[model samples]
Every structure is written in C-alpha cells, then in structure tokens.
Target chain A: MSKQGSASALMAEQSPGPLVAFENVSKIYGKGDAEVRALNGVNLQINAGEFVAVMGPSGSGKSTAMNILGCLDKPTSGRYLFKGVDVGGLASDQLAMLRRHFLGFVFQGFNLLARTTALENLELPLIYQRIEKARRRAMALEALETVGLADRADHTPAELSGGQQQRVAIARAIVTKPSLLLADEPTGNLDSARSHEIMQLLTRLNRERGLTVVLVTHEDDIAAYAGRRLDFRDGRIVRETRNTGKPSHAQ
Target chain B: MLSNTLLMALREIQRNVLRSGLTVLGIIIGVAAVIVIVTLGAGTTRQVGSEISKMGSNMITLVPGGDMRMGGASGAAPPFLAADVEALRRELVGVSAIAPYAQRMDQVIVGNENRRVNIVGTVAEISVVRNWKVTDGRLFTLSEERSGKAVCIIGATIRKEMMAGMEPLGATVRVGKLSCEVIGVLEPKGQAMFGGDQDATVVLPIRTYQRRIVGNDRIAQILISGADSADLSDLKLQITQVMRERRNIAAGERSNFSVIDMTEVAGVMQTTIGVMTTFLSAIAGVSLLVGGIGIMNIMLVSVTERTREIGIRLAIGATEREVMLQFLVEAAMLSAGGGLLGITLGLIGAASIAPAINVPFVFQTSTVVQAFLFSAAVGVIFGFMPARRAARLNPIEALRHE
Candidate 1:
C-alpha cells in the first residue's frame, strides 16, 4: 500500500494536469475592422497548489487571460475546466458560485474598503457567504492571524501602513478559505520593503496551506518568487520558467 | 441579512458624512414642506368648520343686494334697515330669533386708553342668534334697544386691550362720537370662524347706533337663528321672500337682498380649503422631484467613484444582486434619514406657529407616514438607474478604471 502511494505521488508530481486546464481560448473586443483580438488560441494548464506568475507588457492580454481564469470574464471561444468542470457551459450565477467557493482576489491598490476596519474588510467575503456574525468574526480574526494582522483588526486601511493594508487585503482574500488566490500586481503600490513583506505573506499562504496563487507583476524579482512564470508578448505566451523557489528571500 | 446591509450602508454614509448631508438636504426641505403645509391646511380647515359652527348652528345671514362675497359688502344699493329685520322675524316661519347688526371700525376710548375696535350696533337677541355669551355683565335690555339707550357690551378683546386690569361694567367708554355705558363684556372667542378676531367687538343697541353714532337706519346685516328642527335652506328662502316683499322688489326682478345660509358658507369654505391644500401640496411635491434628482445625481457620482471597489466585490464573488443592494440601501438610508429629520422639523414648526396664528395644531399620523414613505420611494425610484448602471458594468473595465 505504501509503495503504491509513493508511485502515485511521483506520478502526480510528474503530471499535475487535472486541476485546471484551458484549451484554445480566444477573446476579442469590438467587431469588424475595429476588432482587437486580446487572446488568440492560448493554451495553458495550472494545477492545484501551483504558485504561478504571469508577466507581460502593456496591452499584451495577460490581464485578459487572468480575467478568464478567475471567471470574471468569458472567452469568445474556449474550454476552461476547473476540477474538470467546463467553464464555457456554466451560467453567470454558477460562475459566481465557483468564485465564491474556490477563488480569492487581491489588487495592487490593496482595495481594502478605505473607511472600514481591517476586521470588517476581512469579514466581507464571509458576509457574502451569509455566515452568521459570531462564526464570521471568528473566521475573519483567524484569517487576520494568518496574515500577521490580528493586532491591526480595528485599524482602518487609511490608518495602516501600505504593507499592513495589503496584509489586510490578503486576510480578506483568504477569509473564505478559498483554494485559489488571484492577485493582480499585489505589491504595485508599495516600496521595496513593503513589497517584499507582501510577497512573503503570499508565499506563506501558498506554501503553508497549499493555496494556489496566480500573481501578475512587471518586476522580475517579484515574479521570481513564484514557482512558475509565464511571460507574455503581444497576445501569446512567449516563454515559461520554472524556478527552484524563493523560500530564502521570502522568509 | 438586511440589517447587515443597512449597517454597511450607514457606515458608508457616516464615512462621507458631509457629502451625505448635502445630498439629503433637498429631501429634508421637501419632506418638511409637505408635512408642515398639510398640517397647517388641516388645522385651518378644522378652524373654519368650528368657526362656522360657532356662528351657531342653523344660522343664516341676510346681506343687502346679494352683493356680499368673500369679504365685506360695500353697498351700491341700500343697507338693511331695522324694519327689514323685524319683518323677517314677524313673517318668516321656523325662525327662532332675529338680530340686526351694523359694524363700524372705530377707536373706542376707555379713560385715556384707546384702541381700534369693531363697534357693532345690534339688538339684545344678538347673543342667542350668534351663540355669543356675555361673560361679565348683561346684554342691553330690550327697552334699551327700543329706547335707543347709550349702553354697550364689550367683547373680550376690547376688554383685554382697553380695560385689562379693571372691571368694565357700568364703566362709560367713549365709543365713536358717543359715550356708552359698559353693560356687559363677552366671552373670549379666540378667533372668528372666517379668520379674524371674534373678540374684538363692542356691541350697542341698533337704535342707539342710528340715533347717536351713524344718525341713519342703515344696518349692515341681520342674523337669524333657525329653530332646532327647521330646514335652514327653507327658512332662508322664507326670509328672502319676506325681505323682498318688504323691500318692494318686483316679482320678476332678482331679489335685492341675499339670504346666505351658514351651511352653504361652510361648504364653500371646505371646498376652497380643500383646493388650497391640494394646490399647496402639489407645489410642495415639486420639491420632492428636485430632491429625487439630487439623490440620483449623488448616487451616480457614488457609483462612478466606487467603480473599482465594485469591481473588486464582483471579482471576489459578489453577485450583481449584492452590488445593487448596497447602492440601493445607501439611497434608502439617505432619503429615509431626511424624512425622519423633516418630520421632526415639521412637527416643531406646526406646534409653535399654529398657536401664534391662532389656528389649531393638528398632528396627522397618515400624512407623516405617507410623506416618509413617499420620500423613501423617491429614493428607490431615482436611485435604481444609477445602481443598475453600477451593477451592469463590465468587471474588467471597472477594475481598470483609474
């Protein structure tokens, strides 16, 4: 039984293909002569618990692809499968259900509601989930603890440091205990130290709880923290790099 | 769930306290205007009803030449004579009593104190015909009415203005050009049924008025109180006929005299007030439109300002329904808050101002409730378009907004 388990583990590491798969995706904006094809015939696969970084220049359609991956937008033509369930066939509300249960998002701006306390910000996703107040508070506090922000629960975004605000945003993202975290330039607004701190937080969330993270960034060092990097040019992935990992700097 | 949303809405309003206040100012004024105007109109209507009743039920007034309209009559023909009053009393059926009165706005002097008063020359039956009570002393005797004695009954207002600290009975007051003995003082009727001081009167015998002051038999009008079971309209007709015959109007000619029924007067008053209330409320309701526009403008701005926040919510699993609810809840809180504030302001305004104007202060729960609900509906109706716009935005584009 132990030998069979070891064999299957090695097979899983060799081919981690079942979690998410995108086949021949395309996204077009406008029509006819004015049409802009954002993504054309893009193929990609991201397994569960993979920390992937997407890097591209302005107007390169990396954002479009991320939008599709997060179920925030639909492709003009594609088959997107999460856990082998087809995204193209899912309705809006079903996509919402998928997002509610499986996905969390962080923004470069820290997008913590400006006047709200960190705890309130963290409780937001749970509020949508309709969890009762006591349990929601408990879970929000726990998420804050995970992001090293339990002491700053009562502090508003405006009152916190940029790194703390992003920490609160991360806490908000994880409060629902989602399997996948989508971050768009999560440290884009911060200094080097704050950016490093934010990266470390995301790294810990990914490694410790096995949360899948897909981040978009322009900075090479920031992209280097991911286990895998997909570089884009024009609307196509031009190169891919698998890193040995950044545990030393992340810690 | 609703409470949570409401709390969130309130937090947003509190966060932008100044902006929220400015946004709802129009709503507050609009709502307060509605409540105050409706309340004052209702009080005025009530006052008119009671005033008509206080003229004594089943009452009719005989005005000369049918020319008296909303205001006092300035005669083109001739005034009603003492004989016309007598003839109505003698010839008309279902008449309980009759009194003829003439009015002169003049300065009455008691010692060195002088004030303008409505000097009325009427018979002793004036009290019965008008439901007037002489509080301090007796009304002029019938012998005084016949003999044209220089005696007068002061109304409560004249007493208060002229003789506030003194007993007025047997005190001689210089009324117009004659000195009349104060035989009585009338009970205080705060305001007349129409809209003036009912208490600002000094009554003397009609004969004394003609013999001493005006030196003519031209009385202003005659008041007739109908018996309890009498049809006042029929009695009015009877009085009109007798007055026409006595005044010698030809059979085909329109009667030179007008017999005015109190009931008809009351009905006209009611209709006029009803129309006035509706007109005023309609004007006030225009402010609500302005208020709704204000709400919509603010909400549109809010949606635009929070576009990225909305995108964040949408991207993190918030349904369009949830987005719409947040904005809608914000709007409702704004208008409902304004409504509550407006109601308090209106009640305070009505309470303090009505008494000073000598009208009733009537609190109507229905109007208050209706105004409040209407304001909230205004929020919903106007807030919906902006909220829908916010909800329908493409999340990718919204997130991309700077």
Candidate 2:
C-alpha cells in the first residue's frame, strides 16, 4: 500500500477528525499511600500530516503519553482513539494487529537486533508481516536507501556508528510503510551533527510521504523541528505551542 | 513463517557455538549411554539365544537339584542311576535319544601340555541328544561304551592346545590317572551361555568314567532330545511321571530332579535381558532429565539476555507467539542435534565394543527413532517455561533492560 495515497484518501474521507485523539486520559500506578500518578486527565490530538513533539522532564509523563499513543500501553481511564476507533476497547492481539498495520516505533537505543546486519534489521517488521523473502529484501533495501544508508546494509549495528545505527533503526521502522512513526528520543544517543541528521530525515519523511510523526524529546532544538509542541509537567500538559521558527511542510 | 523462525533459531544457536555445545553435553552423554546399553543388551540376548540353540533347541537337561540356576545339583539329592536312564529310554514316547551324563574336573596331559578340562562321561547317544558332531574321527562304539573301554572323544580346545601339530584322532591323553585314547574330536562349540568354554572338554564312556574316576555307578544328570514334532512340555511330563513312579516319589512331594528345556532357558534369558535393558535405560534416562534441566536453565538465561531483543521484536509487530516459537525452536534444535550426535557415538561405540564382549552388533531402528523423538520431546518440555517467560515480557520494561 502507498502510505501517501492512503493518508490522503483517509484525509478526504475523514477530513475533520484527528488521526489520533486522547480524551481525559489518566494513568495511576498504585492504589494507596505509595501511589504514583503518571498522567492526569491528559487530552491531546494530532491531525494527519502533522509533526508533533512531546517535551517534558524526567517525571512529567511524556514517556507514558507516548506509550499510550503507540498502543504499547492502555490508558487507565477515559479513551485513546486512533482513526476514530477506540484502542482501549480492542484486545491485546487486536492492538498488536493495529500496531502492525498502521504504526512504527524508533527507540533511543536504536534497538536494532544485535549481531544482525542492517538490511536484516530493516526487514524485521516485514518479516512479522509474513512478507516473502525477495519482496521483503527489496523493501528493506529501498527503506535503507531512503535513509541514505544503502551501502551499509551488510554491516551489523556493532560495525556501524551511532548515526548509521540510528539510520538503520529508522529504515527498519519505515520498511513496512506505516502511516504513524512514533519515535521516542530517536537522537538521544547521537552527537549534535548526527542528531540533526536524524531529525532532518524524520522531517523529510513527514513532508514527502505525509507520514505523521510523534517525537518525544526534552531538547529545545529537537522540539523545534516539530510544527507543534506539548510540554508536560506534574502529570499534566502544562503548555502547548505552535512553532513559527521552523517552516514545516506538514504544517 | 515457521521455516523463517527455524532459520532464525539456527542462527541464534550458531552465534554461540561453544555455549550451545556445552549446554547439550549432558544430553549427548545421556542419549549415547542409552543407545550403547540397549544395543549391547540386545546383542547379548541374541548371543545367548544362539548359544542355547547350538546346544540343541529340543534338548532337555535333567539335573538332580535344589535350584538349578543358583548352582548345580545339591549333594543332598540322590543321584540318578543307570536304571533311571534305561527307564526313561524305554517308557518315554516322542523321545529321539537319551544319555546318562556325569562330569568331573580333572587335568589332562598330552606330551608336555597339562590343562584342566571337564571330564564328561556319557553314552554314545549324547552326540545325538546334545547335537554334537565329530569333526575328526568316530564316536566310541556301543561295545566300547558297554565293555568299559579306555577310549575318549577330545574336544576342539584339547585338540588345538594338546595336539596342535599332531594327529588328534589317535592321541592318548591322561585323564587324571587313566591314559585314555582319543577316538574322535568334537566340533568347536565356542563358549557356554553362563561362563566357561564348551570346547575345552574330554568325553568318555560312562562305565569307564564310573570305574576309573569315581568308583561308582551314580549318574549326575541326564540329557534327552525330544523329536522335532513333539511338544517338549508333554514329553517332559511323561519323563517326569516315569521318573517319579520309578523313584517311588509321593504324589504331592517335590521331585528330586528338575527337567529344564533348553528353549525355555533361552526364553527366560531373553526376558531377563529385556528387563535389564529397560532398567539400565531408565537409569540412563535420569541423565536425560538432568540434561533437560540444563536446557531449561540455559533457556532461562537466554531469555534474560535477549529481553531487549524480544522487546524490539514485539514493538515491531511480532506477536508473543512468534517470540515463544523462536526460542522453542532453538531449544529443540539444540537437544535434537545432541540426540543425533549421541546416536552416532553410541553406534560407533557399540560396533567397536560388541565384538570385544563376544556379542553381535544389533542395530535397532525403533530404538534409534525413539531416542530421537524422546530427545526432541525433552527439549520442548524443558524449553516451555523459558519461552513463556520471554513471550510474557513487558516490551516497555524489557527495552529498558541493560
């Protein structure tokens, strides 16, 4: 499936709806005196083709909110909707299917399987999708080429630099052509130059393919790359702002 | 998908070849032990069967006794007489031949060589009853047996050792104090089932052995060969009945003699070997249990080590089943590979060792197949808990693990 074509078609059919929505979502860890509240009545939305950044300190629930958005965790209360379908109502397996069909994930650790080559790492999601070997190889190479690491396909993560490993991780995330790419601190392990390179790659994917991007970072520059930013503090969204400094094609 | 998972599992095992090999060492030894023991046990059973058959399948040995297997006849039981053998010969039907048997341990000297040998005294019918054939000369004549002639039949071992380069048929060997002429050389019968060599003996006339060796006419045992078409049990019943009446034994009392059918002895031996094989295999199976535990232990450690990898797979849309299957396949391959190696080693060991122990090398296909299936099952059973733990891991926490 062409992600751009499906995204535009979905936008034409569901023009006014947000692609992902959280309604009064709250998450609490324990019940009694030792209880901890991670998110409190957090409401948020991201439209199609939008690049949104979640910015918060260590205990500010930014990671918790990203986990809910990625369908890795369920909200304790209220509802999380992806394409107007209630994610909390679906079974664990069904949620997995939803993630497989529509979402991709990038971690701060790059999380490419150790000792596996870059091309094989990129083929991970497609392998889960049960794609045939030849087609999956072709798609994985195309994704690697998109991230400008086509020549490094045969190298393992141990052989590649941090920037190259991140690029491989990005290629893996995009190999299935998922509409939503949820990247949690994608440049957290890279230097300033590599971090900018990774950010630019995300921006280009969002611009050219209409792939909605959700980034979690505390860095001001990293957040500046997004068209919209939500700052979390004390288990709630303390502020929301739209950036005018960086002209994003999605915006 | 299954093939892909299997390939991935194989690759994972290959990544740590030494660790994998170390982890499966217990299994290798376990399977190999079972294979070797079972194969050797089968070989011994077959050897016993053939040895017993060589002694004549239709032959029944009568011994005056307590328990025959515990030892030979107890001295308390009255010995059989010449009348007992004659009565069995005349009264029993379906009997091809009968012989009065008596033996003594004595040294035989031929020139300078002196070796201890069994001095068996029996009638001319012993050759027919025991299925023994003379390879060199003729058996003692009936007149020689009746008239107490100083003639004997030497066995192959005596022929080989005492008369190696000379004509054995007419050699005179000293049987204790008597210088007996060897009229014939019996065919080499190799070893007996229990112990001792069957071919290390000298046979003489019963009258001659009685007059010279013991100065008595008491027969220690009797040998009877049943007609091939007759049921041995029925023939044994008839012989026992005749002996009981002739000995004037009461109806409900224990008889002084035991009639042992050679075929029954062979059957009992086979059953005993079968039981022993099962017992030894069960003991070997304990090591397999330990090996299974070794697999489980390593698999748990692998799950812990690969937590982050599992998280990555889960986040990338791999289901819990897929993760579990990967580990399960890995463990199965490890144990099954061990089983194959064990079979090969076991066969090699058995093949080389069977002849050393004087038994045939029996390759049991069912045993091999069962061993393989059992080893694979060991892997699956032991691998389950670790695979489940890996599958149930929280992706969020797992990704955060070091």
Candidate 3:
C-alpha cells in the first residue's frame, strides 16, 4: 500500500494542468445500518478561465460537490487537487489560503450583512486579507464599479433592491481578484428578468476578466447559459455536454 | 490587526446601542459605588489624622475605665486626684508636664445673651501640653491657679456667643450665675476627631471650678506629656505603675483607669477606617461582578445574532483569534467606560459630603487607578467565554443560519 501511494504521489508530481481536479471522490454520512453517501466516486476537472455549470436534482449532491470544490468542506475519502496541491492533505489554514487566493463564493441568498453599507460589505473580503484601509476601500470601490453598482455604494443592504443586493455580494466576492468564482444558485432568488441580468453580469466577468466560473443550478434554462454543463444522479456525474446551441442575444 | 478588531467592536456597539448600554449599567453602578465608598473612607481617615496631630503627638489621655465601657460614667472608684498626677510626674522617667482637668456643661451668660457650653477647669500646664494657641490675651496664670481665682479662657464659639459685639479679652462671663473674668480667647479648633464641637469650650482653674462651679475638688480626666527624648514604651510603663500605686491597686487586679497613647489611638483609627473602606468596596465590587456577567450575557447574544457575520468574516479569511479579539475588545470598552464614569461620580460624592461632616477631603490616586484597572479586568474575564464561543463556531453552519 505504501509503495502504491508513493508511485501515485510521483504521478501527481508529474502532471499539473488542471486548476481543480477530483478523482473518484466520495462523501458518506453515517454508517452501517443507516448510511447516506452524498458523493460517489465523482471524477471532474476544471481548467483555468473555463465557465462550467453543475445541474442536478435536490438529492444529487451537486451542493456537496460545490462545497468540496470551494474548499469549505473536506471530502470523506478521495484525491482532490487544487492548483497542483493535494487539497485532502492540507490543513485548515492552508485551505483558508486556497479560498482566499483562488476562490470567491457568491451565494443565492444575497448574503449581504444587515445594517452594513454596500461599501463596507464589499470591503469584507479585503479585511480578511489584512490589506490597509486605503487599498481595501479603493479595491472595493473598483469592484462596485465593475458590477455597475457604484452609485449605490453607500446604501445599506436593506436600501437596495434584490438585484442590487446580489450585485453587492458579487462585488464582495470579486474584490480580492480571486482565480475562481463559485456561484451557488446565483439567480435563484431573483425574478426572471433580474436573474438574466445577474447571469449576464457573471458571464461578462468570466469572459472579460478570464475568471473561472462554476455555477450550480437545477433549472435547465439557467444551465443552458454555461459553456459546458455536467449532470449528476445519485451522487455521480452521469452526463457532460457542451452548449453548441444558438445563443440568445436578449439583453 | 488589533486596531481592526477595535474598529469592528466599536461598530458592533454602535449597531446595538440600547442593548450594549443596558448590559454595561451593572458595571457602572459597581465601579461608582467602589469609588464613592473608598474616597469617603480615605477622606475620613485623613481628617481624623490631622485633628489628632493638631492636638500634639506627645499628649497621652487617661480614660476613666480600662477599655470596658464605651462612654464616661461615674463609677464606684474615686475620681483621679492631684496626687496621682504628682506620682506620675515624679516616677515616670520621661516626665514633661501634666494637667488635671474636670468638665461640666452649663449655660454661660454675658448680659442678655446666654449659650450652653462645656466648662473645662484645668491646671496651668494645659496650655503647653494640649497645644492650645491663644488668639488674644493669655491662658490662666499660675498665680490664679494657686490662689483659686475666678479667671477663665474662652474658646472661639463661646467668644462669639458671649462677647458678640464686645471685646472678649478681659470681659466678664457668668458661668451658672458666678461671674468669671475672661483672660484669653482660644483660636478656632474647628471640630474634634470624636464628633464634638472643640470651639465651644470655656477653661478655668481646676481649683476655681471645684470651689465656685461644680463644688467638687475631684478631677474627671488627666493629660500627660512625654519628654521628647524618652522612649514611649518606658514612659507608658512608668506612668502605669505610678498611677496604680497612687490609686492603691493590688497585684493581679486590673486598674480602674486606663492610660492611652495618642499615637496608638491614631493607629487604631486608621485600621478601623481601612477595614470599613474595604468592606464597603467589596460590596460595591459585587456590582462589578454583575457587570461582568452582563457583558458575558450580551456577548453571548451578540454571537448568536451575528453568526452569519462571523461566517462571512471567516470565509473572507479572518482567523479565529481575530474573531475572539473583536468581541473581547467590545467588552473591554464597555467596562472601561463605566469605570471612568464611576470614579468621577465617586470623587464628586466624597467631596460633596466631606465638608458637611467636618472631615478633610482627600483623593487617593492609587485607589482610583485600582478601581479603573479592576473594572477593565472584569470585562476581559467575563468577555472571554462568549468570544471563544463565537470564534469556535462552524463557518458552514453559521452561513446557513437565518
């Protein structure tokens, strides 16, 4: 077993192309008489600057896969590599560094802190980076401008509309200029028109800024926007498809 | 990092203004009570020390009982006599001056104006032993004491009452209908350490008092002075033995009279006031403990209320230490602010009452600093558990929380 592990370690040291790669990863909750495996031997690879979508039913473990990919949770047993580094063996602090340097997460709930202004919300990520006040403010403002929400920078979450609040969350996520942008049901809480607007903003960021995007959603209409789509069933990716259909130019 | 924590703490406090204010009220009361009690106690001690010092450190008083009763009362034993004074002076190695005094409260009349005052009849040596400074004229002469003449020295209060518009020196004041010529006016002594008006006194010769005032030759109290070069313990022993022999007391039996050193009395007063202040401060310190608990409770609530915020900070890359420090800083600010206010109010309270009660006001820098530091400590200690709880929360769970 030790010889095999060393041989595989040598193989891992030899190949380093994907930004994030998962090989036969599985996560199970409970054991024996009552067991629930959330992920089952999933294999996937996400390259830099690629926009991918994960589509599945409620119990298909898409969220679990997203959590593992975002470095928020560890897989039960598997080999996961983030930027050529073995993620499963990394410490909590190392995982935090990965999250800070490589990944930015935008949740569906428009998770802007209550009673905090839009500018302060955007500055939250840089605060963790220990950036100085002047630099943090400037970066937050630039992110706000990128999201076309600079005019509402001083308004609080309560004062902004659903779309505007989501924009602030996006600004907060992107302010650190992370390599990967993870959006979990990014347009789940918005109306159809607002959802399209938010999706367009994400697409623009991914195309223009060369930021890798991983979007999780159950809706087919939302899944069609991604350049590539992966379908999951019973905790395993059952299908992969490229979006070769005609593009809708409705702004 | 510390400044960031402090800013976050300030913002959190500002966000929940009423909740934070209510939580810190306990500390405010606790710190305030401690300051007021300690300040007043120190002021009282200072006032007592200065009053005793003014009466001359070398003076020793002979009370009627051997620490038995609280106040002076007529006992079965005869009063202290002039022979006991003479024996003490002769046998004691550190002999200075001795003055035998007797007192009675009676109305003194100067024409139509009459006022009640303590009439003290003492020997000629009282002037030197008691350090009684004369404002005008002079104390009773030795000749007047020897001849039992009706001559008296009046205090500031008596002079004000009897000689309101007239010159008190060489004026005549009647004590219980017997006219005695005032030979001197004593300077203002303010108040006595034991709660009596020291300025409301009229002094006359012991012989004159026995013959004309109370019609008794017995002395109520004796005042002795120790020589500047003599050891206090040796003088006390010698005086004790001499007084015992003069009173004819046998071996093994406790003496009827007690000789108390003024310095010893001052020491006892200092200890009593010190203990009282500590006890009051302890009671006040309970409020600080309650204040600490309040801080803990509010911090706990704050953690629960800001769980999502904590998760966001964690996701953004804040370490657990940073989260813990933020909450701790908030607690410290509340407690320190309360402590500062308490010290100010306490000083004000002490200063306001010191003059009314005739105690010299004093401010102790050490006590003020101690109270402030203690208040801050309360915040840190009580604030720790809540901060730890906030830091240890699961980021995933907290993010999912509504």
Model 1: residues >4 Å from true position, as ranges?
A1-17, A56-60, A190-193, A218-224, A237-251, B70-79, B105-116, B158-167, B171-181, B191-197
Weakest lDDT window of 10 consecutive positions for candidate 1 chain B: B66-75
Better of 2 and 3 by DockQ: 2
Tell me, by TM-score, which candidate is best: 3
Report lDDT (Cα) of residue A66, candidate 3. Answer: 91
lDDT of each: 0.84, 0.89, 0.83
Q: Write the per-residue lDDT of candidate 1 for residues B73-93, one digit (tens) a residue.
A: 456767877777777767888
User: Which is the better candidate, 1 or 3, if ranked by lDDT?
Assistant: 1
Which residues of candidate 2, in runs, are more than 4 Å off?
Answer: A1-16, A244-251, B66-71, B177-181, B212-214
Model 3 bad stretches (over 4 Å)? A1-16, A244-251, B68-74
Question: How big is the positional error of residue A146 in model 3, measured in Å on the Cα after superposition?
Answer: 1.2
Query: Whose lDDT is greatest here?
Result: 2
Docking class of 3: acceptable
Model 1 DockQ class:
medium
